[model samples]
Target: MGQGLSCAASQDHRFFSAVHFGDLETVNAMLERDPSLLYQTTYDRQYPLHIAAANGQIEILSMLLERSVDPDMVNRQKQTPLMLAAMHGKISCVKKLVEAGANMLKFDSLNGRTCLHFAAYYGHSDCLQAILSAVQSSPVAVSWGYSRFVNIRDGRGATPLHLAARQRRPECVHILLDNGALVCSSTGGYGSPGTTPLHLAARGGSLDCIRELLAWGADRMQRDASGRIPYVVALKYRNGTCAALLNPSSAEPLVWPSPLKFISELNQEAKALLECALMEANREREKNILKGTGYSLPSPSHSDDGTDDNISEASDTELCCICFEQVCTIEVEDCGHQMCAHCTLALCCHNKPNPTTACLTPPVCPFCRSTIARLVVAKMKDCNDADQDIGDGGSPKLRKSRRSLNFSEGSSSFKGLSATFGKMGGRGSGRIAAENEWVDKP
Candidate 1:
């Protein structure tokens, strides 16, 4: 038994060495002497085929395959030779392996990841394209109807699109999208549920990825397990260009309005004006009813005032700086400048002070002019609550802010806006304008 094992080990070492050093002549000579050495594996379970493919020894790989080496033979990691070639960007080797009937859908046992996933993860655009072409052209794929391999998810529920986006491979992203990879497909796992390719692109800070994803109809509003959208992820990672592109307000101006559409939009404005009037009238009627019942609406101060009146007495404390109406209920993190919750939500959560204007790039504290890292709701006590010290010494108990609001709900409104705007004949023109503006910005 020991002698047999030693002989096997010696043969494995020789085969692997020849493949690794790209000694095609030596490999051919060895194979001719002992054809069974083709099946010998290294200590790591890597066969001669795996080594040659990994090292881009295309000639050696072709020879091994021609000798009837198992193209789908898995090593210790359950990775086939095709996967090895695709991962290392050995495009010729990948083509040869696929042509020899290597399985494209075969996944590594460790991660349930396919060759395309490895190619995308490693940013091998050419290899990815080759694999995609192979799968699409395969006789088995056509007969067995397995074209969905392009969008196959791995153990982490991440598709090749997700991996490509995460790796910031714009060319890979484009290839996958063109090949029917789902743009809105998300990752699955405890770490980041519902994290779509767009979210990955935003986190990677790749402007090209962002553009490709958005162009391919990636859902920007899709939230992860942490309740973060692509825009929020961009901001979290300090990807200002991506955040700006994802900003809803800035996105509108990119699409130029057509003259005919502009004329048609006047009808929508008239309808909106009518709706506003009706809403105001309803509110006035409610106020009148309250007045008739001898009850008055409480002032903003009454809702937020704690035991200490001095905090409210501070200069510029009566009204929020952003809205200049409602009591300040939110504070800029690190700066402690107070503003109304609505204004804070508009600025921090939506990236704009008002819904109509473009979002601010590199958001800053309106008062201190300091960079606004985040926004938190200030916990306020009602007049009936017990006395509590409100000081700068301790961390403030923050109230849940607008970040928790359902992002889907906000995006639904945009969809409605788009539909409404599209009917006005400006859809095509607006999109062209937006695309141009996005490309021109510094």
Candidate 2:
């Protein structure tokens, strides 16, 4: 009784300091002198083995385990030494802990994060491999070590896979995917528009990760609670390469319903709208110019020329506003305004240079200049909100207004609403022309 009490008193005094200094010899001598001291814990409920493993003291860790010290004893924080070992990338300590049958799937008290969650998060591939091997051999569907393996969410419902994707660890993503992590796990944080791993990949700008997720059957059109698609997310970030990748037909035109077809249809609708607008503007100009003035009848030479020929010629001379180049193709935005094709393409990208001033992501309706979605704040409410009416084909219903756009008045060289046409004031005699229909020759 006296020997036991003396050994206990001596160990109690040295326990905290010995563990802190990683004194394997003192720890072994104490354990040898009193075998029961192996179970003696510190104030924080950490066994000698726990501290050794946490601090990456592999020699002391191995000795403690060989003497039958419990490897699964958690600290007051409810974190096993294994959790610390994995998190800190201690390969040898991780191996000792795993070999000792430490609870691989044990969750931390606070975040409910498991050891694999920690290992994968910190990119400890060797330790992760050991854990996976142990996991595969366990009887439970999710190994007991991973029983709480971060497959489920916290109060917010973000899974471990979600965290990995967000952290942008490609290797971690691969490991999780190989270990059967769900690709489509959703969170309440985003509502029905909860972000999938692909969403995280999009946010991380990992093109390879994005492709891998897609190969694993990630839905490209899967929208978040706000109905924002992956490509739309890419656009808001100004990732043009991703935007074009999502829409295969953007580079080379594809068949029906492709980006090209979609763009073409939108262009036609915009042209029809522009044609009506241009006619009105032309009438106003003619009325303003001819008002209170006596005009002579046109000569036979002028009268015989084709009106269509002149309008076609005039349309060809109009330059793209953003690029200052002659327009190639054109696209109309939700705001009922027009821009060159390249400018429209640039606006929807997340990777193009200098996008804020030149690009037009949604929520900033390209034409009306309204903030569609606040990119800076990451708000991606669906373009078709209940408050905003979407027409038959998911296009927003344009608000009607008397404000009309005039080609000459808005043109760079047209100089303050003058009705007189200069000799070199572009091809058409007096009218706006359709796209690609501009007359190249008289």
Q: Give all TM-scores, in the order shown.
A: 0.56, 0.47
State, as a TM-score between 0 and 1, how close model 2 is to the true structure: 0.47
lDDT of 2 by residue, 1-442 (tens): 9999887677676965676677877877777777776777776777777777777888888877886777888888788989888888888898778777787656688777777777766777677667776666664344433424536564356676676666676666666665566777777554455777767777766654654454344566777777777778777887554554444222111111112223233434443332222223223232323334443222222212445333232233233334333232343333334443333433332122234665322323333445432111112234345224424432121211111233333444333212221111221233332223211110
Error of 1 at 198 (Å): 0.8
Point to the candidate with the largest TM-score: 1
User: Model 1 lDDT vs. the true structure?
Assistant: 0.63
Per-residue C-alpha lDDT of model 1 across residues 202-304, encoded as one tens digit per residue:
9998866776676555666778878888889998998765676665444321111111122123344332332222222222222333433444443221222
Model 2: per-residue Cα lDDT at residue 269: 43
Give the worst 10-residue stretch by lDDT in candidate 1.
254-263
Give per-model CA RMSD: 20.9, 23.1
